[model samples]
Target: MSTTNTDVLVVGAGPTGLLLAGDLATAGIDVTLVERRPHGLGNMTRAFGVHARTLEQLDARGLADELLATGTTLTTARLFGRLDLDLTRLPTRFNHLLVTPQYEVERLLERRAVDAGVTFRYGTELRGLRQDAEGVTAELTDPEGTPLTLRARYLVGTDGHRSSVRTALGLPFPGHSVIRSIVLADVRLAEEPADVFSVNGSGDTFAFLAPFGDGWYRVMGWTRTRQVADSEPVDLDEIREIARKALGTDYGMHDPRWISRFHSDERQAPAYRVGRAFLAGDAAHVHSPAGGQGMNTGLQDAANLSWKLTAALRGTAPDPEALLDSYQSERHPVGAMVLRSSGAIVRLAMAHTPLTRATRSLAAHLVNAIPPASARAMGMLSGIDIAYAPAPGTGRPSGRRAPDARLREGRLYELLRQGEFVLIAPGGPAPALPSTAPVTAKHLIRATWTDPAKRTAVLVRPDGYVHWTSN
Candidate 1:
């Protein structure tokens, strides 16, 4: 039984933990990641839609283009069999949603984490965790039941919904199951959709179809007539029946490669942080899979918390509690919002009753009629419009996302690959916070606008949010 110490201990090697650990390691902080599963990217995956904001985050890390190459992109998304959520007009470099599996994302992030020197301990399970005024101690056991101890200044539980770390913290996950007996399948479609993601279902049944960019389509459907358990055996005939009812056709789906049954739940931990241990990803919140927001939300959580932890570890932030507390203040509300929005989407799609279906119709018509409303809806779903509440008198720019800008020498996201605070001054100097000089500022990058005539300087956080503006 040996003990280890690091600056941060990240439980779970999922997307959230991988990104957080990579970001920390890139910032020159020591991070150790532990997982119960073996070190391999397994094939079972359902999460596929990667939103624009997530691509922006990945772009900042220099992995977005690589990820894009591995997936298909849908410029427009149809909802409720009619209304369209256009993604082409989003004000970002990566606008459309990239449809790729969760495993593909994990593969890239894991590679980045490894390259950044994150210590990984696979087949290690967290049994218990405790935190004091100084730090957290995590008790672990290997596959052979050998005990190991880990101590870190900060610990994060990105271990997901059935999180052992969250359980160890004594936090209550309060929510109800949203949908049941939803079937997922990967098969060769005799007829592929004209648009990459147009197959949608509404009425007494619900179904969705999208390509996996490998000649296979991921089909999801549910029905009232054949409600079943997650562990129950399922066949293609049942799936085809539900798809026919919901989608009008099954697109001649055959030769099933993988099939599974799952139930969606809407749950959120009472608190994200208890002392030095924090929860992210599915550990903090989870909702229905209607809007494809689960993995995207988790990745954004990693981006938001990574820099704050770095600031705290380096003793660079003046108010460490406020800085760390801001993670909860900023992200928890967003989590709640996603829960409501995604729940609504799933419920609308899964509407089996006439009254609920009528409400869905009316809601769809309302959004379709109002252009601004539709834009806002897509913005929220895409995570581009998400923002923290600014301090009083800071105005609109303080809490919003800083759009990727073209600098005189390069691009803002290109510069962000260094994982630092970026100062965009329109032909001006970085103000005196620590130091105005970029060369001297350890993790701060100073740049000028491509158009030298412009004159507003915005300081962007490492996670691409507006820290403050020089007005």
Candidate 2:
């Protein structure tokens, strides 16, 4: 047996875990990341689309260019039998959607975390944990199955749906089984599709298709019958058949790379935090993969919790516990909303009734006709609609997500790349921040003032939400 100590012990090296580890390490915290798998990127493409908000977060970390290079840019997301929503009109430099395989995302994040001095123990699994008032003691097993004990001030679970840390903590993950099983394949197509994204809601079966790269397309949809068991095996021929039926044409699916079937389940942990141990990403919340929000949401959760934990550990905040509670309070509602929205979308898109289909079509048409309403509706799917409630004693706008804007001297996101809390005052010098403060603070020159006399100052958290402000 061996013993080790660190400020934070993060379980799982997936997107959420890697992002959080990078954040903690960049903040100068001692972080150790453990993964059950060996030192190789997983081939499975669990998620592909990274939204605008997530791009802003990554840009703040100086990783936007690398990620953009690895993925293809998507400007339009069209609904079958309906108008296409041009994402370029959205208010960010990353107005377009980035379609990169999940493995690529993990690889980029892992490299960044390693460069930041994060200790990664691949092929090591978290066995159990016990938390006291002072810190958390975790039991881990090495690749050779050797036992060890590790201690940390905080333990974070970025593990997947079947999280050992969450199970050991006795947290309840209450949700229903996936009713519809859909096939996902990553393969090079002989012929490429014209549209970047296409949705087919004309038949009893609904299909969604998106082209990734190298002539590869991701096809997802539900069958008319719910007889397909979630765990049942799927094949390439069946997937091709579904694509043909949904697209109303036959396309060759000859060269297959990987094939798998997945069901969408909506589940969230009862509470994000239990004592000194906490949860983030899929370990904290799981929802249907509609609108491609699963990975983006998890990444954002890591971004939010990282800074708060850093502040607490560095003694910049009043109490670590105070900042910890905000995690549950702020994220729980967002998770619930995502679950509700995704579930509704699945139902509407997979509806079998003619009347329901007609109604949905009409609704889509009406929304697309009105540009403002259409933009707002599309924003929900893009994750730009999320807004955190204001902190106490801070008179700020509610339900408005933090916007990425340009400052007179530098880009707003450039300041955030340092992985520190940023204070953006859009007129002149920022308020007198604590000189010896633990958190990173910066002043910005505003190009245009929202309020000429107010001298608006917005304090953005690591997750890019406006946590504090002065008007």
lDDT of each: 0.87, 0.79
Model 2: how far residue 227 lies from native, Å? 3.0
For all predicted structures, in order, the TM-scores are 0.96, 0.92
Pairs clashing in candidate 2?
60-417
lDDT of 1 by residue, 1-471 (tens): 899999999999989999999999999999999999987748486788899999999999999999999888888888778778788878887778898888889999999999999999999999998888999998999878899999999999999999998899999999999998999898898987765565366566888888878888888888867777899988899899988887788889999988999999999987888889899999999999888999999999999999999988988776678788888989999999999999998888877688998898898898889989888998998999999887344456688988888898588888889999888886655565422212227777889888878787777888888877766
**Leading candidate by lDDT:** 1
Cα displacement (angstroms), candidate 1, residue 152, comes to: 0.6
Backbone Cα, N, C clashes tallied per candidate: 0, 1
lDDT of 2 by residue, 142-231 (tens): 999999999999999999999999999999999986446877777666767776576775546767777775467777766775347768
What C-alpha root-mean-square deviation, in Å, does candidate 1 show against the real structure?
2.1
Span of 10 residues, lowest total lDDT, candidate 2 = 440-449
Q: Which residue runs does candidate 2 get wrong by more than 4 Å? A: 398-400, 426-454
